[model samples]
Target: MSETNSQQNINTAVTLLERYAEGKRNFSEANLGNADLQGVDLKGSDFSYADLNEANLNGANLRGCDLSFANLSQANLQDADLRGALLFSADLRQADLKGAKLEKADCDRSTHFPQDFDPAQVGLQIKDG
Candidate 1:
């Protein structure tokens, strides 16, 4: 990434953290690449179109969040609760979803998964038009 983009990401991450600390959870269109947001309780937040590549979100509560079109590539989502989350068209390539709860979470053909990763095996459902 370019230096300006990196600075933007850092700014976004700081803003997100500050908002979360201030009891704000609606973080739509956030740029949080490579951010360390592990174990945060962000349930029902809007993260659509966010850049979360390589972010450490292990054990985060993401249930019912809107993550559509987000870039979650290489993110650590181990043990995260993502039940009913909207992940349609999200990029999950190379992401670690071990033990994650994705029951009723929505995805579509446009959603990208890691190589050989089975969405069905992890309870991720395809969204109907």
Candidate 2:
């Protein structure tokens, strides 16, 4: 990820998560690239078109969330609950999706994936353009 936005993303991630505790949701287009958000319960939040490259979102509860077109390349998304989430055109190349619950998640051919990863094998629904 680019370091230009990394510093701001650090503070944003912390403050954002803190606010989430107080019931704040809509975080669309946030500059959270390279943020460390591991194990956060951000279910049902909006993260569309956000710059989340290399973010540590491991074990996060992201069920029913909107992540369409978000940049998640190289992110640590291990064990994350992404069931029924929107992932259309999301860049997920090299992301660690091991054990993530992708059942019913919507993605399109524009969504990037790891070389060996198969969205169909993981129960992700292919969205038509």
**CA lDDT, every model vs. true structure:** 0.85, 0.87
Candidate 2: Cα lDDT at 29 = 76
Give the range of the ten consecutive residues with the poorest summed lDDT in model 1: 3-12
In model 2, which runs have C-alpha deviations exceeding 4 angstroms? 1-11
For 2-117, candidate 1 gives per-residue lDDT tens digits of: 53343244335566767677776666667788988788888888888888999999999999999999999999999999999999999999899988899989999999998998
Q: What C-alpha lDDT, on a 0 to 100 scale, does residue 63 get in candidate 2?
A: 97
Q: How many backbone clashes does candidate 2 have?
A: 0
Error of 1 at 120 (Å): 1.3
Residue pairs with backbone overlap in model 1: none
Kindly list the per-residue Cα lDDT of model 2 for residues 1-129, writing each as its tens digit: 655443234237777787678786777778887898899899998888888899999999999999999999999999999999999999999899999999999999999988999899999999889
Task: Rate residue 18 of model 2 by lDDT.
Answer: 77
lDDT of 1 at 113: 91
* Model 2 weakest lDDT span, ten residues long: 2-11
Candidate 1 similarity to native, TM-score? 0.85
